[model samples]
Target: MRRARLTFGAFGAVTSIGGFVVALIAACGDDRGGFIQNERAFETEHEGGAPDAETCFLQCSLDGRSIIDSCTGGVVETCADDLACGAAKCQEPCAAAEADRSSNGCDFYFAMPRHYAPSIVSCFATFVVNASNKPATVSLELQGGELDVSRALFRAVPNSTDLEPLEGPIPPGESAILFVADWDPAKPRSVGERVDHTSCPTEAKPALEADFGNFRSGIGDAFRLKSNVPVGVTWMYPYGGAGTHYPTATLVLPVSAWAKEHVVVNGWEATLQGIPVTQIFAAEDDTEVTIIGTKTVSNGDGFTGAAAGIPAKMMLSKGQFAQIAQTEELTGSSVLSNKPTATVGGHECANVPTSAGACDTLAQQIPAFEQWGSEYVGVGYRPRTKNSDEIVWYRMVGGRDGTELEYDPVKPPAAPITLSAGELVLFSARSNDAFVVRSRDAEHPFYLGMHMSGGAGRPPKVPAYGGTGDPEFVNVVPTGQYMSSYSFYADSTFSEHSLVIVRKKTHGDFKDVWLECAGNLPDWKPIDNAGQYEYGRVDLSRQFGPGDSFGDKRCTTGLQRMRSEGAFSATLWGWGAYASYAYPGGMAFRKLVETPLTPVN
Candidate 1:
């Protein structure tokens, strides 16, 4: 739920700090101290009248404390009680970000998805693109389980002819990093059209898969990556490795994107393979996590003691993770943590629909609860097989009580629905279908996920337009999380690679948005409800494929970037034969609440 924001004070005040100065403008509110609410020098909320600048300065000076001149590196200045606290807290992260500017400048941790297929160790490949040019270094250590970390943790230098590291400092203006090891010489010469493996050496031991057995508790498949520079992370299963499923690669969000609360979302798990699993890894020590199951759930064998209304709890240290798995779908389950955590939802093999053919590996990172939005533009994936009428199922889960949902559809209309906290509504639509979901407001945000089952029977062994892909589940990116620009990869390994983009119709025409590979946007249709948003599904397969390896300036290859003058949301999809995968193209990851989030006491 969104919290109340403290309005500004009444009068404007100017202060000089170090070499820079900033002016903020806000409307008037209740009087605060001697300044108008909009013009307070500090954002802090004070009961009654706030302390005057001179008074706060005296308070801090009397304590023998000096304040940092700026959140960025700045000279020390005489402290004001009001500015002292805010400056002190902001300086910590700001200073750290500067130190880590060579790489992603935030906390770094990852709980990679577990893709389990029999007979093979399972190919779990992770790529980190050093987005910065400085000679930034990165280290990855296995966490969470008692597995053989030495063997499972791999270090790769993709550009090196041999498995040696880059001889000198890497160049500048680059934003990604790739690790390469000759794990296997006989594997496919290429993983997907997404990246060039022709230069990757083929000499190493077998690839390592996540330790699924340790998921019942904590301390298993999680891993932590540390870097001095800001970088982008990507995870792909069986891509370069030897496996047939887990078809897609997703842009991994950094630890700054992690949150304290999340709700699980996944495809149908009652398949011949393993069950669906929802996992969380803590970023701080002694973190407390609670799970409220939307259905009967268990980690492994017996019921986990978490049920529809009951909650199960766990204690974890930094880098530790907990998994809640059950054969039944755990879509509406909720997880609460005292500290920030990476929340993931996946299944060993899941059927897109109860009757779809060929179950495939399903994995997608679920966004933090605070990231869910009151509004969503939902679009269905194109059919891969002959069934042109492929239907995508959607589930909108309410985050709070008394949440009323309104659905504006481009096709068959949906009736309004009311939901209590944690409750969800399900609906089905076809490829051409587009809909908008709006709640009363931000406080009643909801989570929505999409599922694609084979049109009818089993998916064909070869690629088919309407007949493609087995059971697949992907989150519907909310309009609120939409970002203005994104750098993402597409594994055209599937015959079909596409993107669904949603933006406010009031903005400029499609030409304003530019794609690195595909020139000029195509296939745009205006959304009906209030004529507020327009949806587009761009077939970008030509941009991906056999060519386009490493770029001249970028440290990596086969990567694509999109930019727009306006804010928008997008989702990526790919399908080939019975293999298909989908996920949000990117996210804003901005804090939804005005107040810093605090754990429920």
Candidate 2:
């Protein structure tokens, strides 16, 4: 199994800003709102509809000064040929085009000429906004470095686990503020004052510095996150087992860095960004803290001490730290939530697409990742109900061309694909049906799920009239069984898909040998005759354990029968009521095993 890679470092900083004082200062100043009218000179537009570079540059330089000049299709030279600007020059060559189109994702607002600064110290961080119907207000937080948020109102509410919002609404078209103020008159303090220059006049030519690229702020111990296994949530549980009904497990990933955007107020190492490191455990020796289980945190505000002078702290007991040490050793062997890499591997491939279209692809395909023996687990989405017994499969259909979805049964659609570790491969549910790749262990069993329609609106809704949604896909191997790593692939950009080599442990190792067909169940039919030519790939490192359960429809199948009382919403707290935790049931029902299919390119 591949070890999880650290993607974004956890950096944060928190400083105080008075209400009236900040409002007054902001009112008096003409903030140099970072605007990207044209993408970088060298960067191409992913949508393939970007205006000409000359047109964009002309529009951007209506004020009579070229901030960034295009060099080639991939590079941009900042500042004009004439040294006609202020101090601080663009260190890195700017893109000729305004957009980083190669990756097919949104361009960084910092890449724009309006706010290109080589370094950012005690100032506003770059804000990015997509071209949506409604504008977006980008909120800036400095976790790894120094920042102060007393003046800014977080667009999203604060959470205890981390100092950044796990989820929030960034409107289309609208814009927000992320100003950096090192010296506040009201506070009468600075991150150590270096200078107190007056605001630049709106008409004055600005300095020729480049915006501070996304950099780390600081890092430290934050929170401990624990997974919760609900009781009686669904029929997925056995009446009893060798262990207690509630299995308590703790996984910890240390926070080593943070951002020092505008909100940071003090020195580094402040627990400003309370990234959920590991779940608190009862076995810990520290009495000052207790296990609060796990809950998804939102916003960039970590739980700080009520008092201003006291530093924010969530110190785990020595025993707790020991537990962290033990679990940290688990690495690629175990699961660690909160750390995007553990939930999904985004760094496996040496190179991953960073542009808009492909960026979303990276995000969507990561969760589909699973380690072979240690964590291989099947992931079946909500499936379709059919009157015919034809082999059925599931696909990922909607969202932006590459907008990926989450796969966590608990965090459905939250992060359908986490690219913390590697490149992303988006799947069109219809064009890309789920298939089992070969397994590794013979005696160790494997598991699979029949994708159904429902939840994130990805699955087909099963209608009444004796309609059984999706296919009841059972595992090819039984408990204590094993298989080797298998390969599974489909058309990269289509929705109607096929699966081949569905059953052999050693078959279809290469992409060419496997033949495909148009209808579902590609391998069930004669492949040599008339099936299309296609292939699928699977990784075996991501394996699952017995009782390691996943299948939203399984529990919903029976639970939906009891839904006559009223239409209900899935709540985080009420997740257990909807979930089921059971040992891989008897083979007669569906063989449960350790090996599962994790789709990757």
Candidate 3:
């Protein structure tokens, strides 16, 4: 399966026969205009043949037009006008190019969380270039569980023996970086301390040697990234110091768009800074999940409990993940799965309500529940100093058992809050106003979460407004999952980025969208209770490039391709001095499949 043949060069024009020898001596006294001008120059040289010589000039132009039509005895046809130009120039579709078979392959699943300190959990899997002209050959596979390279450890940066060829063709639009995996918590040491390998740091030295020896602590492990086309998978979790770093990254959705039900939650947790975990995997095999909420089960040790009440049932197997550490606030919790499953809520260093500062470890990767949405438009997060006050927590989960909500500045704790199906309710808004959550009963669909307001660093002065800021988690893209097109990637070391869009507010005003990027566009703004709801914000730190600025280069990292005419749903939000993250630049509506050519009638 290694064939690379590309050659094309054909140019011949030696027609200097002295003006075609006086027009072929006046067409040999006019033998039907020199046999129709040499049969129109042999059908223009078989119509510029050359695909392996066009099957030998289409069998010599169908045996020279069948020997000039049976010896031309009955020449009532000037060779039948070159037999329709030799069957339209030597016909040959090659059986539809050998029955075209399309599918340039592209499977995905990524997760690497686990390491709140001694540091080392790097994982890169970039692959931009959403083809506009081919050139993509990416391959990656690291299935889950059982890699026991005999009590392994980890590090991989340019070293490999197995992890299946990753770095690939990736040309067309450009973007490629595959250094998957590098977890060096100082190499399995707890005895006498000290197991140097140069103490693991030379910018994390040429990694690619993992071995958490069956790794599985706080649910963090799942890998799969096959690609031959359709790419764009991101991952990053660097910076593990000062209570285990605070850098984050996202944009890896493609388990064929996973979805088998999910409602999971986590956005406000800060006992002394964090604790709200969640992690569920399972791409097949047995699957059978089921985890209602309000946790409370301990001894069995699946990862402690108590996020609401209780309801658990398990059976994962395919790359298993399961981590669930709750402290009460999983928002109506529900996870039902039977096949596709992939969740990843956050917090192990939260502090959003504890006055946003200090603790930092928020995650994201939850978007199923049939893509929840009954209309949502909450935007919040823009106050690191301006008199400081940018908190906006709002959780709502109820897909049955009574559901009913309708807010729009109705400042509540009111309006039929009778949940049940998955039950969850939490709402807040410290002023940076912009809210809405309609859903009388759109078949009982409801799911909205948006928490952003966690200052960072100097906290502990604790009083009421809670220190100031550092907690982050953004997930509110449901206007029925708006997405008129998108192609994300933006977390260039966080220094403060933004992109909260959210749309829907026609006739009465508020529906003017725009956000191109790289080519530049940006200009949305419209949130202020102007009727149906519409919000905007952009800022992308000078337009792109940062996450180390795509060193190896390829599509130039400025990856953002948006579109609009109405439908909207962005959400990118990086953070400043203390680090932050948020993702989901689009969702719902997927249909791309067009690579079967062979019908040149």
Each model's TM-score?
0.69, 0.20, 0.27
Residue-by-residue lDDT tens digits, candidate 2, 7-61: 2110000000121000000000011111122321122121111122122111111
The worst-scoring run of ten residues by lDDT in candidate 2 lies at 20-29
Compute the lDDT of residue 421 as modeled in candidate 2.
16
Instruction: For model 2, state the Cα shift of residue 110 in Å.
Output: 44
Winning model by lDDT: 1
lDDT of 3 by residue, 204-267 (tens): 2323455443222333346665554444455555422112236555555566556666677665
Better of 2 and 3 by TM-score: 3
The best candidate by TM-score is 1
lDDT of each: 0.50, 0.17, 0.45
Stretches off by above 4 angstroms in model 2 are 1-314, 317-384, 388-428, 435-601
Q: What ordering of candidates by lDDT runs from best to worst?
A: 1, 3, 2
RMSD for all candidates, in order, please. 11.0, 28.1, 28.2
Reference-based TM-score, model 2? 0.20
Give me the displacement of residue 263 in model 2, in angstroms: 26
Taking all chains together, the TM-score of candidate 3 against the true structure is: 0.27
| Model 2, C-alpha of 17: deviation from truth (Å) | 68
